[model samples]
Target: MNKFLAASVSPALYATKANARIFTLSSTEHNIEVGNWKIDSTQLGIIDSFFSIEQKILHGGKQEGSKIIILTSPNGLTITLSPTRGMSIMNVTGQDIRFGWDSPVKEVVNPTFINLESRNGAGWLEGFNEMMVRCGFEWAGHPGIENGEMRTLHGKAGNTPASKVEIEISEIAPYEIKIRGLIKESTFKKADLQTVAEICYIPDTYSFTIHDRLTNHSDYPRDYQIMYHSNFSKPLLEKDAQFVAPIKEISPFNDYAHKGLQDWATYLEPTKDFDEMVFNIVPFAKNDGSTLAALHNKDGSKGVTIEFNIQELPYLTLWKNTDTEKQGYVTGIEPGTNYAYATSIEREQGRIRQIESEQTVHFKIKYSALMNKEAVDKAKKAVADIQGAQKTTFVHTPIAKE
Candidate 1:
């Protein structure tokens, strides 16, 4: 058994016949590899259910050698996760609505083919198609030199492959399905960080949750930053698609973004050769410190929502890239400890986070598909309630110093 699983799962639970099922797909320490495997409800003695998980490796092109896990829920939702790509979520489909973008770089390019230092440090864009990808365990932001060290775009968290991958399914009512991956980002005499990424969902739900725990394994305290880059495209994102959030404060990312400041909460039709705009935001939260952001289609009939604890993720970034479909039209609802700027700039602004040796930080985000007008309306009202009568402070210019 993997060490992580042994520590998480109770021995008595596995001792019972109706407890849960655990499958280890890959583990370097245990020398375990179950290539091209699958398990369904029938195998688990589950009655009349559609829950299943399949693991396989892709072949050919830049995607060759990439490991993908396809999960089918009982509620007609299908998710594709790439463990080889730092456990990033590749695609999500529910009720004929896809929760991912149409990027020109279609393949799930393996990290082996991605040279983060190439193209002047913008090579991360080559494998930038995931619906949700992590940025940073060390540094995350624009490509630049920070304290004489070259930092690439968004850091290397998303490109670092998982060292262990496993699946667990509860036998109790609700029967939660969990896909966990352990990723290690380490270097000698520098940084040693480990992230345990888990994606969990009930058997019959249109929603899923991401729970990640990042630990500092070094003997000394280290500074770090992390961000969840959640991207979406049509049919949830389209012309007139509104980005609804409980905004307390907001600002344009730069001068170009200022041009679209007035329409920051709305989206436009896909335009040819469109320049992307970014906004930095501080959101209003509920009493429990939980907040949500939603993207609804033009008619409000379909949408998606992301929920997180504002105390853990204090900053939000809205990325609007409504370019032509051929150019990969998309928008990103990013949550992070800091905004997306050069790490040096973030450090100067005192936004970077730090962890003591052997300490861990936890992050959780819930994503749900809104399939009806009522669901969309409810989500919008929730944001509105959080906003209440508070006026939003809109900055005419960017906030961070460059």
Candidate 2:
């Protein structure tokens, strides 16, 4: 037999759990599997050559007893998910572009571990720093009570641990490897909700998507409010950073937002006593079923574009909290089913949504970065199209008292 043929171990190949095909090589006749090579179905239109999922328990300050699930792609893209924090997306990074803010607290602690009820209801902000946090089901902001039941700021969804957590990876068409996470949030005789997130990465592309399915599991109908509080920090947000969106109507939650309305698209250097301002926005969606919002440095070399499903989540809230040199300096681009109002106010205004028993609502938000001129221009054009299609109106309302 030929030397190479004699070294062949077997005519059959093995498959890895990740669908990686492995071939065997041997040293001699009666050959053993001496060498093994892995072959993924790359030719099947997978964008990423390598994909991996890692889960670890976080330790150290504030993160003790918390769990983190990290998903990595071949192009140095990493997504961190916190199961303890309502399976929130804690970070999204690649190629030194940090789209999420890093908080002072290192650990994901249970809300019960913090004394958030103190300090006049400012305690819920303890774990407020995350990439994409969910605020809803009961209350989205401020301490409020309805029918003698009380809720703290932003509600307990962000802090409440998911009882059922699952992570799955599939090697199917239209994706190389897709990671899907299912987190279920339910309480006995209280709230029953679930958030299903599918992280899809396209082959040879730098963008990924977060498709979510939010379902209500309670027996009776219940009032539900949800807001996607996605935060961005430095590098992406700088002194001359510009915020572009297809805002159809803009208004201030208070005088602070009113003061910044004229220059709402511009950012300032960190300042003192910068009262956090909230701008309520009504965006105009293009034919693609998505509205664009972006924040980039003045040079426009690097930035992020968020394409949100405007059909499901119609309201957008922009938060500017450049309060101090530290522990502040962050901007939030939030889209939600209702305005960022307290449960009482939202209910009073009839802005809250009612989900019937066993009914589900879907929400989607896609994040893609603009690291070059072409990407930036594409975002600009998208914004211009949205802006040109509609006339922007202004609504000035008095701030709701906490």
Candidate 3:
């Protein structure tokens, strides 16, 4: 095969007469050498790709599309992304760099809402793993959930209530990897946008229709979700830990806690610190080296970056687990369309045009290692030109909630 999950091997999870339990166990891993970087994808659903972009740890493909791994160079520059989802810089710290203006978001809609990615759900690299965590970053998250009551990030098939997943390596790539799994449909009464039942779930699962991707293309598509779910070391977000997006400001939405309006100036470039779920829409980077969103360490110190191309996905979400009792120690920064099967407000407002069913949105996702904030700005602008405004308005204000 051109590529496949490395060390691919499966074990059962049904506690049988001898086992007498619920979940069995299985695993797979891969070691890839791409140029100067080495990548590893395990059956546990974890992917880690590393390279020397500069001094920083420029990485990509965290388990949950969260904090990406670093790929640094000598000049203290690097690039990272969940290109499969939406390429975004998970971290960058060093000399002033340039990536460019924010790219416009993209969306096209598909006929099937559940386009099964894989059975094992691509292991930990799978966004909906039992425990959502970084794909190729410094940390991975709560591997095997406890008591099956644990709330997983994306809540993959195996991680759900009574389901279990198993991954099968299919291919390996210089820029990406591929895998498959058996996903049993699940339901929960409290789950939003999710189906639920008493003691049964869907049984119509097909391993034949499964796939996954990871890339670093500058002009990638924007239909699928290109996100990053991360749980930085517990030390990262202590009241002072920071987070920033290279954009104007997050649009006011019902799902998040807001600090101001959509046009508020709270989105300062070179932000000293961040500690909330930030959603960015405006293009912040300029050719002259200017930005709108950025995260710094507490005390206005230095830290990592979390930026994405607006063209591919103008929308962004920065979720923080502030209340430990409520959640875990992770921050989800998803760079994609809001909610499921929705793009921006423009589509809802009839500004652009709504997508029809079965409309396949094709595009690319990219990641690089660059520590300069300026470089990031320049790169962002380059992407915007191609992704212009396909639609406008998020919900067309005043629409009665269904």
Candidate 4:
């Protein structure tokens, strides 16, 4: 019943991409006041190579500062892994963020490597951005889980495919775009990232795969990982930063926090005082532990709600790098598929769900950028209004998931 303005009244006025569904967006209407910080895309406008992505605005090219980039879809599939907090969405006064396999979207470092390292000028990664960037997250690189009977395990990354993706810019709601990518069970390495692949006939499901080659070629097992390494602007986060999640328990980052491993959802500024930022295995305080993730800020402006559903993934990671100086100034609320492998431990012990090799997973994540008390009230009212329209299983309040 959350009255998420999924469809905007704003009209689309751009070129379309063949057969696609366009959604609405009021994102372009805001008047922004960008600061002295000018964002120049290295891959595009900036004279210097900015190690960014090739971007083409779908609408409203007349905004002020280029800090946010908002994306929408019918199904809940937008950002992944280290998703942007107030970041992305070409906002006027939200936050700055980065993206990609190994590097960040805002050019925190060069666009080379994922989980691995490539030293050099790319080390420009030092400084404020480094402290704010998400790092050291991991995941299975191919579709489904890999099981082992004796020695060898799941198939290599190249077992699935990449051709399943289908992108379309809308003709009707041309402002919103649609991307319908799938995994027809072909190649694995092609789908490195955990992108939800379309499965025809099924109600709600996502298939993902991976494909990577370990260059050293040591006669051994190859461990793989792929998560969108996101880093956010720390200065913008209030002053006294803290994280919140809905989880009952959390694996503290090297056992760091207020006292011991309390509920994983709430975070306090580590006593060791990391140079940058990191909220270890955080979650939302009230979400029934059904989801994972949390949002922290300085001076405590209420708090943002970030959740990771079990459909697309299961694990959530929190990396705290607070010992360095200078750029080491931020923290991360990392989300993942296997909770540092501890989730698996719980599952095997019958505390959580377990998956056999080659099993498909599916879940939906709902992101509501609730502003102070105002936004929370709006959402509550929305849930109330839903009962007025169509009969819901529950009443007005957010019912706990059974």
**Number of clashes in every candidate structure?**
0, 4, 103, 59
Candidate 2, lDDT over the whole model: 0.70
Q: Report model 2's TM-score to 2 decimal places.
A: 0.83
Tens digits of per-residue lDDT, candidate 4, 1-402, equal 311112223333222224433222212223222222111222123332221112222222212122223222213222321111111121212222222112223332212222121131122232113222222112221122224211111121112222222222322321233322222222244222222321111101111111111121223222333222333334323334544434333433332333333432333332354432222232332233345343544443333333444333445555444332232433444454433333233334332332223333443333343335454444434433322343212122211110
Reference-based TM-score of each model: 0.96, 0.83, 0.36, 0.43
Task: Write model 1 residue lDDT over 111-138, tens digit each, in one string.
Answer: 9999998888889999999999999879
- Which one wins on TM-score? 1
- Report lDDT (CA) for all predictions: 0.89, 0.70, 0.29, 0.29
Error of 4 at 148 (Å): 15
Which residue runs of candidate 1 sit more than 4 Å off their true CA positions? Answer: 1-18
Candidate 4 deviant stretches above 4 angstroms = 1-166, 173-175, 179-238, 253-293, 296-303, 320-325, 341-360, 376-402
Better model by TM-score: candidate 2 vs candidate 3: 2
| Candidate 3: Cα lDDT at 186 | 17
Where does the lowest 10-residue lDDT sum fall in candidate 4?
Answer: 199-208
* TM-score of structure candidate 1: 0.96
lDDT of 1 at 370: 93
TM-score of 4: 0.43
Candidate topping lDDT:
1
Give the C-alpha lDDT of model 1: 0.89
